[model samples]
Target: MGEPQNPGRERGLDIILASRAYDLGFMSDWGGAGNIISTLYSAKSTNFASTWAKIETKARTELANELALFRGLE
Candidate 1:
């Protein structure tokens, strides 16, 4: 009989596929914007993943700050 598949591995693969699809759609719609911003900022590389990580980090930090402020008001 064939070996059983690992559910963890299957889930990981699914996540990777979804991430790739998202990246493709994002690039298709805003790919040129990245280039323009990079040029304006004098960035040497237009790495999508790096830019996305920075944006996500900023968003999370902002959200956390806002939540903390709201909680203090209570």
Candidate 2:
């Protein structure tokens, strides 16, 4: 039998990407969650997973850097 796989990883990634995209204002001013979702859907492609991973890494790094700066101000 094959090994069982972790199912949440994909869902987790989807949530992360959607949240990050929303945070980054990847939507029109008049649009809302639906627009964000549509934008993400339109961005889907064979390389999208790789692109999303890169974006996630960059966001993590930026957030960590911001936190460090904030801590320094204390």
Full-model lDDT for every candidate = 0.58, 0.56
Which pairs of residues have clashing backbones in candidate 1? none
TM value for model 2: 0.35
Q: Candidate 1 local accuracy as lDDT?
A: 0.58
Q: Write the per-residue lDDT of candidate 1 for residues 1-74, one digit (tens) a residue.
A: 98787879888988998886344323432334334455436776666566666565555565566568779999
Best by the TM-score measure: 2
**Per-residue C-alpha lDDT of model 2 across residues 1-74, encoded as one tens digit per residue:** 88689799889999988886344333322223224345567777556445555456555566676668779999
| Candidate 2: residue 32 Cα off by (Å) | 17
